[model samples]
Every structure is written in structure tokens, then in C-alpha cells.
Target: MARLNLWRWGVFGLAGLYFLVPLAASVVFTVDVPGQGLTVDAYTQIVGTGGFGSSLLLSLELALATIAVVLLLMVPAMVALRLGAPKLRPVVEVVCSLPLVVPPIAFVAGIVTVLKWGPEHLSRTPLFQTFVAIQNPDFPVVLVLAYVVMALPFVYRALDAGLRAIDVPTLVEAARSCGASWPQALVQAVLPNLRGALLNASFLTLALVLGEFTVAQLLGFRPFAVWIVNVSGSQAQLSVAVSVMSLLVTWLLLLVLAGFGGRSRTTSRG
Candidate 1:
């Protein structure tokens, strides 16, 4: 037992170093200047930096939109598949997981082709406006669409695990017997049980949007990740500083989410 405990601690120490060493190095790089012993100028300048605020705000907006849209589409579909057509569940799972198999470069290339095609061929038609509107750089609804695709596998897995853990049909039937509609049952009964899964999916989608570079960069849109890279060319310290701060912020958000989820679960139980 003592030998096993020692080995577990050793493994944990190694894993902690593996993740923490790089983060420590980045912190040093940001704060430790050659002549100057330590300074926080890098962190201080983040807000004043060009495009920093807008890019971060844009990324948050994209993440929120992605979470809402993906949940709105996926939750109902998954529930229906589980209840009405269990056999089709595998087919739906495969379709959702296709994004994982597809390379980002290929995915972005396809998007680029479609965008170009819309303007070239569909010009002078009502659908042309539809294409033009989605590409608006201010919000770039196209990126939200792309993110929804990229997020499918994670969202599906989270929701599926949640659904499998709970008896969906039984819950729905009970709710229906009590004079609740399908939507009402889902909203009041089904979603409460799915609290944890929903949080996981939302957090994963947010992380993906914040960290993703290829799709946003290729689409010629400037979000937080691209702005960080752009900042690196001019101010390396500030870039690393931004990266560290973003990491901390993400961790803080996760903790808050976890706390909120826990409280909700406790309240539901009570």
C-alpha cells in the first residue's frame, strides 16, 4: 500500500511539472526582463493594445452564440433520437463525429469555396444577400456556423452521456402524465437532470472558440487567438502575458461554472 501511494504521488508530480513548467516559463518570460529584475508592463499594456478589446469581445460573443445555437439544435435532436428512434442514434452519432475526422484545413477550404461561390455565382439573387449577411465581419455569423460544426462531437458526447445516465423516456412519460407538453417536460424536467452535461458542453465550446486559430484566421476574421499571434510579432512579452491571463481567466470561469452547477444540483435535490 505504501509503495502504491509513493508511485501515485510520483506520477502526479511528473504530470504537474509537465503542465506547470511551460506555464512557469511563460510567466518568467513575461515579467522577467534582462536589465529590469521584474516588471508588469506587459500585463498592463494589454488593454491599451490595438484590437485587443474588440478581438476578445468578438471571441466571447462567438462562443456564447455557439453555445446557445449548438444546444438549441442538438439537445432536442438527441432527445428525440433516444426516445422515438433508438436505432438511428448510431447514425446521428456518426454524423456528429464527422467533424472530428475532418481536418481543419480541409474544412476551412470548403468554407472558403462556398463563400467565393456564393458571391460569384449567386450574385443578383435573394440568396446572395443571405450569403453576404452571414459573412459580416462585425459578427461573422459564418464563424458561429463553423464553430457549431467543430463543437458537435464534444457536445454530442456530453449530452449523450448525460442522457444515458438518466432515463429520458421515463422522465418524459412521467412529465406527460402530469399534463406537461414535450417542450415543457424537456425544459423543466429533462434539462435540470442535464445540468452538468450542459455545463461541460458549453465550457468545451467556449474553450474551442477561444483557442481555435485556423478557422478564424483562414476566414480573414480577427478574434482573440489571432490577435494574440499578431501581438507576438510586435510584443512577445505582452503576447505571453495575454496567453497567461487568458489561461487564468478560463480556469476561473470553469471554477465559477462548476460552483454554479453544484449549487443548482443541490437545489434541485432539495
Candidate 2:
């Protein structure tokens, strides 16, 4: 058993090293050279290039938009499943989880085709028009929508787990006994308990949105990932610097979300 544990730790350490080595090399290469031991020129050059800033801003916007949209869509549906029709929870879960089962390329391609080929009147509706306006494959909207879809599973699972964790019957009965309406109980009791799970889902969704590349690339949306690829192709040093900056930004966002999630979890337990 001790030998097995040692082997597992050894494998985990090697895996960590494998991932860290390239990142360390990239940072070193950006900072070190023959004559100059260290320099911030690479970073300055990346910032000086106007495209990097625009792309970074666009990526951040898309991530925020995706988070907002996902929460709006997922939270209500989850609440309904948890408090309204318990029998339909499984069906709802399957439906939301379908995105994970389907190949991203295939699913996105189908969505594109439906948007292009569906009825003219339907396509011309205000909602459809707005969706197209925000999500033109030629712009950053595709990235935003793709992020929402990809992050759905995380949000759904977190919410479902949260809903399951609460003492639903007891809360409902207590509220009823106290002359509180069903809606009031749900708003006051259920929502409070679910806060931790909701925050966790939001964090997971944010991380996924920040790192995604394929949908953005296929849809021709210029985001941080695409910018990284472009910069790498042209200037190696600038590419490394941008990559490092991107990592820092992503890490900071993740840290903020993690802190919220941790606090919420502690509150839920209390």
C-alpha cells in the first residue's frame, strides 16, 4: 500500500512538472537572452500592440456575458425542478446535460445551420434578431454563446446538488406553519441555501469560458486565445509575454471566484 501510494504521488508530481515546464520555459525565454539576463520589453511590446488589448477586453466581456446569461437561464429552470415538479428533475437534467454529450463542433454547426436555414419570419423575430446581433460568428458573440453552452453542465450540476442538499420538506412545512406563502419560502429559504452551489457553478463556468478556444476559432471570433495564437506566430517573445499576462488575468479571476465560493460554502455549512 505504501509503495502504491509512492507511485501515485510520483506520477502526480511528474504530471505537474510536465505542465509547468513549458510555461516556465516560455516565461524565461521572454525575460532572458544572451546579453540581457532579464527584460520587460516583450511585455511592453505586447501591450503596445493595439490588438492584444482589444482581444483581452473582448474576451472578458464575453466571459461576463456568458456568466450572466447562464445564470439567468439555469437558475430558474433549476428552481422549478427543485421546488415545483420533482418528478421532472431527471428529464431536465438529461436535457441540460445533452450539450456535454454532443460533440461541440457538430452541435455548433447544427445551431449555425438552423439559424441560417430556418423560417424567415422566425429568424426575423426580435429575440432571434438580438441573438444574431450579439452572436454573429464574425464577432465575439459566438464565443459568448459557446461559453454559455459549454458551462451549462457545471451550473446545472452545482445547482441540482445544492437543491438536493436543502431540507425542502421541512422548510416548506415551517413556512406554511408560519403563514408564509410558497413563493416566500422559496425566496427566503431555498435561495439562501443554494448560494454556495450557485457561486461554485459560476466560478466553474468562468474558468471554462476564459480558457475556451475552438468555438471562438471556428466562429472567427477574435478573443484572447486567438490573439495568443496570432502573437505566437509572429513574435515569439511577445507571444510568451501575452501568454503570461493572460495566465495572470485568468488566475486572478479564478481566485476571486474561488474566494466567493469558499465563503458561501462556509455559510451554507453554518
Candidate 3:
């Protein structure tokens, strides 16, 4: 028993050192500048910087949009496949998981080609307006679309697990027998049982959108991650400070998700 306990603690201790070492180095580099006493100067400058507010806001908006779109698209599709067409579930799963196998650079490259070709070939068509609108630098419809694709696998898995745990067919049948429509059945009867899954999917998608750099950067949109890299060029310490803060924000999100999830599980158990 003592040997097993020591092995477990030793493994955990090594993992903690692996994760904390770089974070400690970053904190030191961010605050302990040569000849400058420990100060909040770099952290303070994060707000005053030119693109700080806008980029962060843009990323936040993108995260929200991605969450909404993923939920709307995946939840219903997953439920229907599970309840109505079990055989199609594997096919749907493969499609959702494709984004995982496809490299982000290649995915963004395909989008770039489509964007370029749309203007040249489809300029006279109504779809050209969509192309123009999606590229909007302010709120980036393109980024949201890209993020939705990137987040599909995570959202699908979360919802699928939730669906597996519950009696989906029975729930829908009961809701229907109670004179509820399909939408109501899903919105009220089904989704309540899926609160944890919903929160988990939202948190994962939000974190993915916040941390994603290659797609947003290559797509010519400046989001939170891109801004950090841009700021690093002239203000190294400030960039590290912002990166540390971003890490904290992501961790905070995870904690919030866990809290809500725990409450949800307790309620379900009761």
C-alpha cells in the first residue's frame, strides 16, 4: 500500500513540475525585468495597448458564435441520429471527426482558395455578397465558420456521451405523449438532462476559439491569440503577461464549467 501511494505521488509530482516550470519561468520573465523591481507595469500596459480591447472582444464574440452554432447544429443532429436512425451515427461521427485528422493549415488554405476564387468567378452572383460579408474584418463570419468546423468533433463527442447516458427515445416519447412538439421536446425535455454536456461543449469550444492562432492569423483576422503574437514583437514582457492572463482566463472557464457540472450531476442524482 505504501509503495503504491509513493508511486502515485511521485508521478503527480513529476507532472506538476513539468507543467509549472514553464509557467514559473514565464511569470518571472514577465515581472522580474532586469533592474526593474517586481511590478504590475506589463500587466497594466495590456489594457492601454492599441489592439488589446478590440482583439479580445473579437475573440470573445467568435467564441460565443462558435458555441451557439455548434450547439444548434450538433445537438439536434445527434439526438435525431441516436433516436431515429442509429445506423447513421457512425457515418455522422466520421464526418465530425474529419476535422481532427485534417491539418489546420490545409483547412485554412482551402478556405483561402475559396475566398479568392469567389471574388473572381462568383462576383456576378448573389453568393458574392456572402463572400464579401464573411470576410468582414470587424466580426469575421469566415472565422466563425472555420471555428465551427474545428469544434465539431469535440461538441459531437460531448453531446453523444450525454445522449448515451440518458434514455433519449423514452424522453422524446414522454414529451410527445404530453403534447409537446419536437422542438419543445428537445428544448425542454431533452436539453435539461444535457446541461453538463452543453456546458462542457461550450467551454471546450470557447477555449479552442480563444487559443486558435493559425486559422485566424492566416485568414487575416486579428483575434486574442494573434494580438498576443503581434504584441510580442515590440513588447515582449507585456506579451508574456497577456499570455499568462489568457491561461488564467481559460483555467477560470474550466473551473466554472466544473462547478456547474457538479451541481448538474447532483441534481440528476437526486
Per-prediction RMSD in angstroms?
1.2, 3.6, 2.1
Clashing pairs in 2: none
lDDT of each: 0.94, 0.79, 0.92
* Candidate closest to the true structure, highest TM-score: 1
**lDDT per residue as tens, model 1, 167-229:** 999999999999999899999989998998999999899899988899999999999999999
Model 2 has an lDDT value of 0.79
Q: How well is each residue in 187-211 modelled by candidate 2, as lDDT tens digits?
A: 7766777777877887788778767
lDDT sort, best first: 1, 3, 2
For 12-73, candidate 3 gives per-residue lDDT tens digits of 99999999999999999988878978888999999999998899889989999999999999
Q: Could you tell me the TM-score of candidate 1?
A: 0.97
For model 3, the superposed segments whose C-alpha errors exceed 4 Å read 256-270
Query: Each prediction's TM-score against the native?
Result: 0.97, 0.80, 0.93
What overall lDDT, based on C-alpha atoms, would model 1 receive against the true structure? 0.94
What's the CA error at residue 82 for candidate 3, in Å?
A: 0.7
